[model samples]
Target: MTHVMACIDNSQSSLAVCDYAAWASQRLNAPLTLLHVLDEEKYPAAADLSGNIGLGSREHLLEELATLDAQRARLALEQGQHMLEKARERTVISGAAFPELKQRHGHLVESLSDLQEDIRLLVIGRVGEDNSRNAHSLGSQIEAVVRTIHRPILITATSYKKPEKVMLAFDGSSTAYKTIQMFAASSLCKDLPIHLVTVGADSVSNHEALGKAQSMLLSAGFLVQAEIRQGEVESALHDYQTEHGIDLLVMGAYGHSRIRQFLVGSTTTTMLRTATMPVLLLR
Candidate 1:
């Protein structure tokens, strides 16, 4: 069965990820899976110290190094299992049904890719343990996952807040329309008031596109307030979110517009890196 999958680690955002995942699972009435990936690169089972080992004690040193590597790998695996169990307990406390636990040894994106077929929604932190120290930097895995995973992804902030209002950053692109269609079809966030906002010129075409999207949501029984803001896409959206007190931001993951550029581009914007609310990126 399809499920809401949350990627978690020993970061400040992991707890938030679990909370959001439970919320999504309840909203979508889907199973929840807590996934903890022990990156092989970070916790390798064997390290080649042959080059550095002196010739006299090479064999003994290699044996000791292998033993140490094994111990490290074991410790990592145990830690991941403990994290998964704790996350499951937290999810249950958050009012979600029992969630399945999964621990894998590999890259996060690769694990998500392999499990994408059964994922209804993916909830992850904006930054992982590796990047948690740098508050201003987006997790390196985020861009790769966004570019690779076709499923709807909820990139969460450092903390979890039960969302009351949602904003859709529409751009009138095909991907934006797809985002609208998906939002209208899904039960997730259907009970909340939605702000359908577009940051660009207030032209006839833009309004028409906005109207079309609004109509789609309205037909789906969504309370949508469509508006067009004038300024830079990122800044305008950020200001609108602040002014309106939006709790969650929704947008297409990829398109021809600046939104797509900032998301999967060479450089990620501060908006995503410093967003105070969760971002739901639809493919």
Candidate 2:
């Protein structure tokens, strides 16, 4: 069966990730997979060790470093397993049915991408253990994972709250159209109160596009409210979200260039970074 993959690390947001994942799993009636990756780069306290030792005592120090790396890896492996166990228990308690646990050794993005086909939904936290709370940066691997995986990704906010209302930030791009279609076809957004807010200067095309999207969602049984407004994309969407107390934001990840849309200058990234609620990004 397809699974809702919850990617977690030893971060403040890990619990939130599991909670959201469990909710999705229950919603979709899919299995839950709590995945914790032990990437050396992500866990430098455990990564390979070769460069830092001095030349004169290189060989001996290299041996020591190797031993240390091995020990660190072992500890990390155990820790990751423990984390997965805890997360599994948490998910089960949160109404998930016996989530599968996975402990992996590799880069987070690559590993998840390889398993993307099996993932029906992806759940992750805004920040990770390695990232400082002070910065506005996303978890180091989040952007990369989002770009690589075509499945819907739910990026949790500071905490979890059952979304009372959902907003679709339509931009009238091809990606936006695709996102609306996917959302309409899926039961995930069906029956939910959804607001389709498009940001653009007054134009016939923009109005037509937003109206069409709204119609599609309505056909799928969504209680959709469509509106056209003018402003910068990110700020305008965020403002709408705030004004409406939107609990979830949906949008397309990439741009005109399907393959490179999310690489840069993507409004999806901006919204994901700053959204006060969860972001359900469609690729």
Candidate 3:
């Protein structure tokens, strides 16, 4: 069975992510696993340790600091567990039978790496405390997973709405093709309309790529519409989604290194930061 994993932190955005994952689970006839990683390190208690003055003795201060850190870690774990339970219940209601709920007690990124082989797709909220708040950027944990894991990721934003229209960014790249396969095989595309889009500087390749993708999606039984647009990739996508009322944007993540993407301002980076809709990024 296909495995769809959702990273739940019990945040407002994470509830929407649960909804998306539940939809994917029912569509794929896949088992759902709601995962919560306690990023104990990110929740340092030093910020909350502002009460009485510390004793002059070194051992006393060290013990007090250790206790405070342990308390913070416990709180994070409890919250993470609560989020996982809620997410599991949501998926179960979506006809996902006996969904799995996992709570990891370590680094978020590392836990994801440990489960890479079993995970076909990782679902997450777009903006979290773990990620930077830059309008057009991915958070640190999501960025790390995209860079290291050779799997697909569905990144959702604050708003929660069932997908009505899906936009596919095709460049004829192998990774982009994999993204197309994900949508075609997903429940979101069963009898649903898909906009197969190709952005380029030259009209020839743009038209050819769009045609090829549209044909492929049609063969896979999707209602496909092809388009060739001219502009910077991110802006074109952002603009088209706004104009066409796209519900979900599906595309490939960058194959290049972090430094390389920053140097070139890759489309994945821009879309992650700027796109108004949810994005399903394939690696």
Candidate achieving the largest TM-score:
1
**Residue 231 miss distance in model 2 (angstroms):** 1.1
Mark the 10 consecutive residues where model 1 has the least summed lDDT: 261-270
Model 2 deviation from native, Cα RMSD in Å: 3.1
Candidate 3 lDDT over residue span 1-283, tens digit each: 2688888875556777888888777766678888887765666534444544566646667668768787887788787787777777877775666778898877778898899888877888876654434535556566667777777788887667888888887777665666677666666558768887777766776577667778778988888888877766667777888888999987767533221342124234555766678888765
Candidate 1: segments with Cα more than 4 A from true spot: 48-57
Name the TM-score of candidate 2.
0.89
Clashing pairs in 2: 255-261
Best first by lDDT, ranked: 1, 2, 3
1-283 per-residue lDDT for model 2 (tens digits): 2888998788888888888888888878889998888986634554455566565767767777777877888899899899999998898899999988887788888888888889999998888778747336677667777768888888887678877788987778887789988888776665679999877778998889888898888878889899976766777777888798888888777655322333354333555666678888887
Q: What is the lDDT of residue 226 in candidate 3?
A: 83
Off by over 4 Å in 3: 43-56, 93-95, 130-137, 181-188, 255-268
lDDT of 1 by residue, 149-251 (tens): 9999999989889999999988899878888999999999988999999888889999999999999999999999999999877788888989999999998
Q: Give me the runs in candidate 2 sitting further than 4 Å from their true place.
A: 42-55, 58-61, 256-268
lDDT for model 2, on a 0 to 1 scale? Answer: 0.79
TM-score of 3: 0.83
Assess each prediction's global lDDT (C-alpha) against the native.
0.89, 0.79, 0.73
